[model samples]
Target: MNYAIAYVVYNPTVEQIERINEISFGHPVYVYDNSETISELPYNKDIVLVRNGRNDGIAVGLNILLETASGDGRSHIITMDQDSLIDDHFIKKLISLAGVDDREIIVAPMHHTGDITYDKDLVGKSSQKLYVLTTMTSGNLLNVQFAIDVGKFEEKYFIDYVDHEFCLRANRKGYKVVISKDLKMEHSLGHSEQKFSLLSLEFVPTFHAPVRRIYMTRNRSDVWRKYFAIYPRWVLRDFMRFNKELLGIVVFEDNKLIKVYSIVAGFYLFIMNRWGKAELRYLVNGAKK
Candidate 1:
């Protein structure tokens, strides 16, 4: 139950730093900063802060934190986003649920952010836990050994879909991804707005920049291709979800043409087997728009 807390931060806010100090009372907290400039951390002996001069993406930062935690003889590491808020008993609840399933390699808490929620069916089904394909990175308790065996998070995915890629890899390795309905946390996904059609309502996510859209589109395609045969149902579900998001961007969001172009460019890059940071033209054009 003595797990280390790890989070990758990029230009984090003061409240985030304070929350990290608060939740990491008796555990060692590793802070991997991907900001362009280093900032001062709270004066806590249990908190280990590492500064990367530039943004290396969440996967690389998380892997670094995992390596550091492993070297410190930690068996489990709880990975979270910088802005997420956890309950005071979050770790204790997660540890309890972890003991119920020996095959569980990653235990995720129910995430609530605005109107967005993960695992809606499992929300009040506290007595009935379910095996899921994937969950978000924040508020997920990862088994250190299982992570290492699965080769850690994929660095090629700069940000978007990094967690999904890890979860899919975990599933392929015969590791169970469990959802704890009883445990919940407050987390934010993106700046979303509600848009209404004649018969339905959709939340348009316009918060992410064009660069992030490129990553989301590209990484999603790569992940789908990798696991489509083994997880056809899940892949199909995601395909529909991707189309819905595209519709939202096209219909409800501003700078619609640029985002559509970025999405198309992302798919094109994926078809060409390209990865890593997007081209400068994409970023430049997006910025101009």
Candidate 2:
């Protein structure tokens, strides 16, 4: 199977992309830049850069990478984010776990932040378990043929639920989502981890920026509406997890009021069928006149 590396970079520096240089050997790489100002990459790399010239969101970038690479006769894509770092061994391990029948269309490495966690020693074992609810985009081997049949990604999702929505679609289509049992990767969630305690129990909430909160809330609403009938138990558990995060936000995070209001705005936007990038307000930013 011919494979290629597809990355979505936004406001990336050379140092960020430099991490992938080693593992990206032998396979072609498609870099979809969503930065307002594209940064120049180092010379002497087998990279094809496609600048979207604006922040079109992750889904759009992945869609472009998949289609562009598919046109180049690539059968599979190992999706990645500019910030996530993995070695050549990581890619080999993930691709080795693909189902013999190719029904496991989305094969991913296990991250601590995923639905389950494990010890470090389990970092390369493939389990027969399949069809997981979700997996992070980075370190995933997406079958290009399956993705094409699903009409690519849901670009209107912009960012959040892009991978999960696709995973759900794949499951519905008789394809499976597989994960390696012991292959561990440090995939982070939120801006940073915020730890707190309530009712004598400690909790850690994934703290996201206000803008991301809007996407999460809006797309999460859409996911529940669309998939609740098919995934009621998963929806209920996800609902509880979300509310718990909100409780942690109210108790421990900074900018709680603004983030909470962003959630409300996100829900309203969903009601209006508003999809794509959205701004909470013209708050302070790093813009220069």
Candidate 3:
């Protein structure tokens, strides 16, 4: 399958650049840099870099990649984050798995470092393919035409839940999200911390700053509101996940009061249908209150 490899970078390290170049060996690569100022990259014929003057967030950058792939007549596109590491044949593996089913619009590899387990009951022991509720953008091979058909990533989401929203949209359109349990790649979720709560026992949550917490909460709520009616079981499961996360933030994280405030503010924005980046000054000033 002739496919394009793309990475959305934001002030990436030399190690990340080198790793991407290595993994993307023979395929054409599109690098969308969302840094404040463009940085020069080492010359490589297989690599094409585009620098957005300012950070337009992940959703926008991904759309740019999809456009490039579609315009070049590529059938599929593998999207990756700057820090994600994959083998040279990662795309080939995903493509092979995708060949089993025509409805499989997205095929993702399992993460080596993050949550690697999928619901066993939902997948069963007989199958290597696990139909999941959602899959992250990184390390996933996307059918370009199907992705565009599902309306691409939600730009309003800006940063968080971009992948989840896309997967849910695809599912609604009868496209399957299949994960190859055998295929795994090195990827990191975020700066996570292990926290022990007296009430809930043990928990490890990805530690996000107050501002990022706002985006996470807001986007999550937005997605929940949109899909809860259609996918009640999945939505309820996600609701439980959110509550657990909120409890962890309240009981275990620092700046508890402000983080709680951000969560509330995020809900408020979601209820009002407000999207995009929240004003930092307002959050800071409100924190003083």
Candidate 4:
């Protein structure tokens, strides 16, 4: 059976699309452009591009495609970033891992130029464990029914940890979320956190951007309140670990005020039902100092 690809492309230049078109063959591609306005796509009858009037974050953009294809039953939808280059065996592996469930969600493996590995050790035991299965929607595939059942990606996340949030939701619904160790696509690491590395590893330092720190810390609290209430220790442990890291200032820029603000704001948002945007501004001023 042919799987219709619901590919999300945001602010893609012509060159990026050409690279994507070259690699993606033997599938009906639905391209959703999340730019302020849509650009003219190069010819490909099988490819369909949709435009958003404004720049919605990746999570919201994906929700649009999910809503559009909710009932139409199109095998599985493969989420991707515009910069990703698909390996030749990509689709075949996806179909293979899809298994017997026509409504199954199959996630693709993403490879970067440097070392990148999913913490398989955390599979069933850690707070990181969403579900034990095949992939994550960050650049993974999803069954239509499963996607709809989870009510699609939460648009409230905007960006950052949205993938983690989706996986958490899928896990709650007993959907299997696994990592495909065999199939791999190349990804560019850290379009944002090039400067802040603690151990020379590619992962971003939590304190790289004051804005990102605010979002990450705040949204994570939201995740705990909404989903992990049963596992209260998880958030507490993470909070302690983060404080240690902040004191060390190992990987990220050492911004004590910003770090404290992140934690406090995250907590405040949880208890007060507010976003802590004002706190973010205050932290921004402190960061400037």
What tens digits encode model 2's per-residue C-alpha lDDT throughout 1-289? 6888888988887888676565556556788889987567652357787875788999999998988878988878899997788777777777776656667677777776633343321222335544476667898988898888877889998999888788777777877777765577787787555456799856676767877778888998898889899877767766876787788889888788777877787898899998988753522231110
What lDDT score belongs to each candidate, Candidate 1 first? 0.78, 0.75, 0.78, 0.59
Query: Of the candidates numbered 2 and 3, which has the greater lDDT value?
Result: 3
lDDT of 4 by residue, 1-289 (tens): 4456666766688887876676556666777777776567663655766675665677777877776665455657777777765654776676677754333354546444343345531345223223342233545777767877877877766656677667666766666665566666666543334433345533344344555555566677677667657444445655664565455453345665665666666566556765423343545555422
TM-score for candidate 1, please give it: 0.90
- Candidate 1 — which pairs collide? none
TM-scores of all predicted structures: 0.90, 0.89, 0.90, 0.72
- Considering TM-score, where higher is better, how would the candidates rank from best to worst? 1, 3, 2, 4
Worst 10 contiguous positions by lDDT, candidate 4? 125-134
Query: Per-residue CA lDDT of candidate 3, range 94-136, in tens?
Result: 7677656787788888765443345721422236877877877
lDDT of 4 at 199: 54
The parts of candidate 2 lying over 4 Å away from their true place are 40-45, 114-130, 279-289
Q: CA lDDT of 225 in candidate 3?
A: 85
